[model samples]
Target: SVVTEMTGLGAHTLRGYERAGLLQPARTAGGMRLYSPRDVAIVRRAAALAAEGINVTGIRRILQLEAEVALIRAEFDGVPQPVVAASAERGASGTG
Candidate 1:
């Protein structure tokens, strides 16, 4: 598959990532996995992490934390200052 070629990961490894809930490539009507650019990037990152000796569970946690941080940063970017301030206060007060 293109992703396997691009990421230098074996097809079996890619399938393992999917089974481990790391990758979620879209599927065709015929059920062929379709790798988007983002999916490719994720595969590359996961491969790197695995090379660093991170286990699947560790990789999954790191990815989840990274995604949550990205979401928070995006929300902060678009939110008004007053709302941001209130949210910060709530967080500081342990109410958020």
Candidate 2:
């Protein structure tokens, strides 16, 4: 998981993700940050954006949209042409 991969980050960094409205990883019965693949991807993307001059707030919004777009793209890809067009229109209308 990303938490295990990121061995040096302290508690504050974990808290920061939560504060930014990022995924709150499911806790174990004993209380641990059980990150999902999606959560890890978000962290990696946030890091990449930060490296490219995006501030935390901007990164947060971008990450949110990236996840949404990914899901919509996945659904669109699974559907037929008419459905795909409808999905694209929904996205264009900012309703997706």
Q: Where does candidate 1 stray beyond 4 Å?
A: 80-96
lDDT of 1 by residue, 1-96 (tens): 777777788999999999999979899999999988988888888889999999999999999999999999998899999998998999999989
Q: List the residue pairs that clash in candidate 1.
A: none
- Leading candidate by TM-score: 1
Residue 23, model 1, lDDT: 79
Clashes within 3 Å, all models in order: 0, 0
Q: How far is candidate 1 from the true structure (C-alpha RMSD, Å)?
A: 3.2
Over 1-96, each residue of candidate 2 has an lDDT whose tens digit, in order, gives: 457456444467666877888658888999877877777767767767767998888988898787799899998678899987897899999999
Clashing pairs in 2: none
lDDT of each: 0.91, 0.76
